[model samples]
Target: MTVSSDRSPVTDAGAPLDGFAVEGSEGSAAADIAIRQLRMLGAASPGPDVAVRGAGRARARAEAGSAGSLVLAADHARVACALDWAGPLALPLEDEPGVQAACGLMHVHGRSSGGPRPLAIDYASAVGGVLSAQGLLAALIGRLRGGAAELVRTSVAQAALISVGQYLAAATASGDERDAPAAPGGPPFTSADGVPFEIETFEAERWERFWSLLGADRAALARGWQPFQHRYAAAVCPLPPELHATAAARVFREAAGAAQAAGISIVRVHGAAGERRRSDAAEPPPWRLTGGSSDTPGPPPAPCRPGAGLPLDGLVVVESTRRVQGPLAGHLLRLLGAEVLRIEPPGGDPLRWVPPTVGTCSARFLALNRGKHVVEADLKTPEGRRQVRELTAGADVFLHNWAPGKAAVFGLDSADLFAVRPGLVYAHASGWGDARQAGAAMGGAEPLGTDFLVQAHSGLGGLVRPRGEEPAPSLMTLTDVLGGLLSAQGVLAGLLARCRGAGGIRVDSALYDGAALLTAAAPSGGARRPRWGPLHPPLRTGDGYLALGPHARSSPDRVARALGADRPAADAAAAVARLCRGDRAADVAERLRGAGLSATPVCTDLADLAADPRIAGALDTGGAAFVRSPWEFTS
Candidate 1:
């Protein structure tokens, strides 16, 4: 079913794309793009390729091999295809010849200023896609080191680590997040009137109070009821379906009173929260911001300006996307200097409608669609299909995030796009992929949670399984887009394989997959804390929260004295605030370094941090603040 394009892969075909593109849009060309404009603006593309298609061996070899390679999209519909190696004649794959491809897409979704309407946690998965990219890269690197067929390694650490880094980079870069508001906690929905409700969504309990203020029985007053406590007990009973609502409300009010009265909490439930509002109200981590209100780019950095010049450039990419999952693929690719073009339908990508388009479109949309060219097209239309066929011609990589069984509707199913673009690294992402989680429908229109659905359902919640689900839903999500990032790594590995003399490759990461990756630490390890990766967590200091390291612990030895030690010199202000803040009934800890002991500190304002030159510098465009890919090239 491979559709052959009559173009010169080596020499151009007679208008090879002549019959493939949609009418009226035939004059497009990559050379026509303002690549110079982009590169001048600091957006370089992936550079040269050493692999070239050999003398007619690709098709010939494919015809000879029957023990075809199996491309598994998930645990279900596992595919077995005659995957022929065309690298010697095409692009060098990034990994070995065989692989037991990982199942599912890492759905890392986020609600950028401009993104599709609140797709909820679906966006978390969308954002998580960045991790997929990191993991795949790290994994491919690992594979390149050791040769083994049917084997692939992923960076269990890089997925979450890079994600955290991206967020931190975004926040610290502009020092805006320091002043950003906390995420809004929305209204608490009640089931009709009678059924009681529990505060589960968006840290609701932080605002309101829990209660059980059931009143005492009156009839019993005349007969046997005397004590108000007894009546309250019966009224507050959880077993009675008839009394749940009344019991819940009374408990709510009483708890609310006690909490507020004790200066413990308040209500934050109200409306739809957006990026600006959330960032404005967001409780920034207690770190000094080095940069001020500077949103300016640094002297218009060159494309792929990975400091020393080493970077991935001249890379070609086709993002076959819709909603969050697909666009995120382009997002990660763009970060690394790939020339990523987003193919959309006539009205543009469906996600353009996302309430707050963040990037150049919707706020939410913009947040995820950064770094890409948008082309209006309808794959369903012959012209649209033809255009994609034209645009993707000779592209280096391809990615599509579509729901199960729906890929063909737009001719982007696993086989469609890849067949025509063999050495083109390919990636696919979806919920309940073509594997075991396939067939089952998603809850309502959205798939799942905002930031922690995988935590609520899959990670901690234990929900999605081999196919049985509840009619009643509990959450929304963004973890799936993680597939885009992780998938990037997978695709890169494939490309790398060709470089190392292997065949083509396929990569997948689902919300569930990302969720699975998150559960790395041994559940608390009874007494020991887990590794925090790279640097240790931060701690409360004389002024604010600072990342304590051997620097913090041995500082006393290096600078002065210890806290509880009598007659100690150099008793720095570092541990002053922490000494007095005891954990209610327990003693505080001073351990650091090997233990990675870091405190998250009590909730506080970030005004001080935003004003700190060091913190600002750390997040400034001059340092770790700017969005620069970890790459460089020798001029």
Candidate 2:
């Protein structure tokens, strides 16, 4: 709980993770990376109370009773079958899964890319690792409060499911009205001179103005706004071809200048060299933490309620956030047992009325905001601001994803909130950590901190798409989800510090930071030259596609033997596809699993997810078809 920037305080009583152990599977980088991140944040002391073991050794260590808190990372299918949880219920099942570009991760990338194709880069695996880390942190907080040892488990598939939950929610909603088709198309428009870039603005007028300034077709401008604006929620933005044509007519600088004049933010998609330059630049940590004190201190930390099973039970979080990241963080906190009181604008969140609904609520909105309490408050008014302060006085945490500096405009910043709730764990899930720095990164114009733009600016656009394809950011709200996870993690860490007698703390997590973390972990070469592709694209079968997880690339001979094909030394995708083409996807998947490899039929349709046996137990199909909280808490 010490306030030094250099010290690790993410533990109970500032004690290291004395008995926590991680065992099983070498490529379970998610668990390893999560543990490593925690340790870097001071979860572990000098020596290793946190233990890690390779695959097949978990049984021996469990029997020995030396492994304390344990986290296991495996392929989505194995984890799903063993845990009987729907977890990720990945689209692309694969043999020998890891954080490779294929496997379950491919499904996520494909969703963002407008279909089920492999992302040239690794995203889901790293995200799953972060999810595992959050689970571990929540468990540690529980232990800090004198709860028994907790079991934390996650899979890459589960992580994938969590990321795509919003889409699934809308897709799985029952009733007469079907959600709109996920028609393929989106941004990062390529200019005439061959510079690719993304444009962003939440306001429709700005979008219209920017396009008109660039002499885009007037009819296309009017037709394109809704899809462009809703891309975050819809997972696709099929802009009219005329808009692309317009961008294609201008040079990069001319288009950029027009966008600047129109008050729209635009960023060039960084190539390999640009990605490397950005990667080498210093960036903020995933989440920045700072201690704060109230002139008037609040009561001492409350004791954990007796028999309360969830770590955050009895705590209250007042969440005022629009869009995905902040609300998702609040949702995670709610799942962890905090009573989340959501502050919506007058009337309600407009998104509540958007598209396919489960009852009166937007199924997509419900995906992130199902169980929270709600109160309408117009923050633009003084009374509304006063009401928020009153709510904060009784809350343990105040979380938001407001645009940078908006809080201060309303006098609702951390300093303002600390005045009311002295021990509040204030969290701001931001687009860019600092606008000035972000502006510098984009060469003077402060790029909008939206997901796609962040992806373009942070070198993800190049890495995400495969070679020979147009480089563009995955429009899946990727950084927003990652930012949300980081925000919740920060809140839990702050609360843990408070449980150990620390004062109020402020946590700021940014989409830019999340993008930076992913880029930093990727192999060098940025986007101009991708170092990896889908290790193995989903193999086509008689019935459907079968994914041979990342491990398939490692054990080609075994895979070849299992499929009765030659070892694929070259053209592995075509070879693997040919091997499975004669069999049903299920048959191919089963055969690979029998051969001691991870495999499953690719779940191309979200509507069919509830019926999938591997994860049916974890899904609640009575309403919207969203996966339950990924963590299974067992004391």
Best by lDDT: 2
Q: Which predicted model would earn the best TM-score?
A: 2
Per-candidate TM equals: 0.45, 0.86
Tens-digit lDDT track of model 1 for 1-635: 00012211112111111111111011111111112111211222322221112212321332243212111111111111122111111211111100000000111111111111111122222232233223223222222333111111112112222333333332333322222332322112223323222222222232222221233233321222121112111111112222334343454445335434433322222111120112123221110101111122111111232331212355577887765555666776676556788887777765454332223344345545656888787776788887887776557667777655556776765456556654445566554333433213221223322223333333222221101221111122324434445445445544443333333334454544443332221122111112232122233345333323234433443222333534543444433334523332012223322233322221122222223342332222432232223221111
Worst 10 residues of 1 by lDDT: 96-105
**lDDT for every model?**
0.32, 0.69
What lDDT does candidate 1 reach at residue 158? Answer: 20
Name the lDDT value of residue 175 in candidate 1. 24
Cα deviation at 438, candidate 2, in Å, is 0.6
